[model samples]
Target: MTESTTPGTASGIREFRMPDVGEGLTEAEILKWYVQPGDTVADGQVVCEVETAKAAVELPIPFDGTVHELRFPEGTTVDVGTVIITVATGAGGAPAESAAVREAAGSAGAVAAGDQAAPSAPAASDEEIEPEGRQPVLVGYGVSASSTKRRPRKPQAAPSVPGQPGAAEGGPRRPEAAAIQAEFNGHAAVVEGPTGVAGAAPAAVRPGGRPAGSAAPSVPGGRPLAKPPVRKLAKDLGIDLATVTPTGPDGIITREDVHAAASAVSVVPAPEAAALAEPVPAAAGPAREIRIPIKGVRKATAQAMVASAFTAPHVTEFITVDVTRTMKLVQELKQDPDMAGLRINPLLLVAKALLLAIRRNPEVNAAWDEANQEIVRKEYVNLGIAAATPRGLIVPNIKDAQAKTLPELASALGELVSTAREGKTSPAAMQGGTVTITNVGVFGVDTGTPILNPGESAILAFGAVKLQPWVHKGKVKPRQVTTLALSFDHRLVDGELGSKVLADIAAVLEQPKRLMTWS
Candidate 1:
């Protein structure tokens, strides 16, 4: 990913566009913005972090300037080449430009302040409680400031006469009470029909505790009077809007009214729960279920895994091996002067073993090109290590693992794992791998049928290393043992070829001395 700056709408201002962070990727979600609008930023300062389908990457500003605006807020996915932020190339930003921006903003800030008297400046004492007069809207949007413009009070429609043209019903006249607007604690509210309107009218209730005394505004077909948000809330809770009472101005159903109806019909109430109002209270009942939207790395991982699982014919072969000798070697290598300060673990040796095994059975390290009806054999190994990060599972590969010495491979492995854990692995670090290894052993798992990484032919699942009774040298003895499972794409690797690869890896692990001879 590269950051570039282009001349903005105004002079001395540069707009920074969201860069294509991965090969062929068209968009990235803004995970966070480190700098807010109006903050001073220097050249090369990391302003935000973004997540592409492949990995999370930090984007740095390309030039020194004061942040003029953050075009998008966090959690927004932006298309590549779209301008995401603008900067003013002045030490503290030019006053003229700032003034121009404010003029463009107009009363949007007052709306964002969410108060009645937002246009007036607040006293120093009030500033501690209220926000500044010139507050920015959600990413500085004018239309989204939530205008304080109230709808005009809908006049009571002339009562529909029975048997008249366009009368709703031709039956006897139903006595509907007149709607009465009331002030409840200094707020304007309209009470619906009086408690005597009909069945289930909710007991002569409050206009401050007296049942509503007026007719409500209704649609031509009598579908009930509710705003879109209130209707959505009722639908989500499985509440019928027609059953809810209207306590809002102009006979409109409210969110609180729906909650009150819901509480009235609840089958059970917890002993600790209490009705804070006449009947409206956020039910203290524990939620039955919760839903989360899948996105970012986790969503991408799921898509790739599903594709690989169904597209590739996988065959997993397992073998249990004694690694007592290998375990002893790991300890001795830790003390060796040449290996000092280097990572010395069984996984390092396991990786080396796998590399050697691939060399012996090169056919297993190839891909099936169905479109061309050809087999693509790879001469070099770009080894992938499956890492579990907070975002999801990611397999970042070492560029050329077969040619690296033991110390070099160890250092690379350490760096790869650390970068993944820190959520800093770049998209390029995770591409172009011939094979992968997943160390399920770290979690004490015995074995698993590991899935192949998309585009790769094989994967290895390494199980926990533990002391077990084993037949060794014609005798049963306590030995350090572990299970290894190798899964390969059957179309590319036959059972015989897969078996040989698995056997080779087990042999090297069983006899560490074989690493020198095999290589």
Candidate 2:
């Protein structure tokens, strides 16, 4: 039968291309599929959930129709404009159910290649003929490209008039089996009927799952029972729709219900339970071949680092300084009544020092645009703080950070870190950063020349602060000393400019009052 005769064929099939669902995010990992083959969908309806570099986003279908096919399985990383799904648009928007006939229309070489790769199955003995329809699912998955071709259906044989011997088990079971198999290959097989007649039951029910009693009632509500986001919420919250009461107007499960369930279960901390119950080190190698798919933030960082390392002419300068006053300020801030409930740390002071340094050298707070053939000097700073998240290195920045006070910057930094660790930072928070500061001190590292984040002018590395011998008042004294490494795009800032910026940062850390004088 022509696809036009299929309900799914009612609407002509249109392939939906993956869009930049996240803000300027070019690609995404298919986290889950909300609709499957044979499911009806509406325009603007979310059909799939994709995880962008920063957050997970639901991809909405642009056309209304039955889903004809899924181009790729879940967890596949698809670039923008890649066709991920095809929706049927011809037969009243209903998709035609596909038949299950195995046709070898491909070249013999192609079929042989596929068969060779097929998982090994028990070989049939020479005395016994292999079962006709016993091919495993793996074999079907490896079918040749031409195996998708469908042939015209042969005419159905005349129905048995009365108690006629069937073609099965010395009875008429062949005809019935033929009818059912014909649905897939358009060719009939013989099978015994209920009364050992040639044709009693018109269709053979596949064993397993409940016997097909009647067709599922068409949902009168018209709305989809669940949407992409709702389905995701259900899965994350572990709420089974089979039990959750539908409060939606048309008996559909609304986002509210999904959210309510999610909120209810969210407090239970399933991950925490699993982590505590069985403390297995994920870093250790295990059996069954553990594979960490390259995607999300880790993938984006890799791509960006590659681009930046090759494109930017980088120049790094390092200096060691006594940040004793900065450490003392942190202690005072922690005990200050005005700064109560605020997180105080050396990073905050380092951030303040960096801000002052940026003010000293705006050249460091700019971008080199080879395309425009111009140096783009950012008037406002989207200050990125490099955070090492579980996903990977993510630098979520604060917009117009040059405008924020030390206290405000501290709070923003805290929120940024928390949001990044939770994988909730939006793409907006990760883009448009003019400069960045990576706190390698948290890991007790001394210092290293960090690579510039792609498209930015510079990145500063903050080394671990510790008591070290330093000349104070011409006397060697133990002081809180740390190293600051400034890596800048040489094309934009020469050594003189880069060194001056790094010096200004070290000077401020050496004597905190210098910030007040500079500001």
Give me the candidate number with maximum lDDT. 1
Among all windows of 10 consecutive residues in model 2, the one with the lowest summed lDDT is 209-218
What's the TM-score of each model vs. the native?
A: 0.69, 0.58
Cand. 1 TM to true fold: 0.69
Those runs of model 2 whose alpha carbons end farther than 4 Å from true positions after fitting are 1-17, 23-26, 32-49, 53-55, 58-73, 79-292
Tell me the lDDT of candidate 1: 0.71
Segments in model 1 whose C-alpha atoms lie over 4 Å from true places:
1-12, 90-286
lDDT of 1 by residue, 245-265 (tens): 666643456666766666554
Give the clashing residue pairs of candidate 1, or none: 178-214, 179-214, 179-215, 205-210, 205-211, 206-209
lDDT, candidate 2, 176-285, per-residue tens:
34434433432222233455543433232222211112211112221123434445546645564433334442233555665454443322244564222222232333
Judging by TM-score against the true structure, name the best candidate: 1
lDDT of each: 0.71, 0.65
Per-residue lDDT, model 2, residue 159, is 43
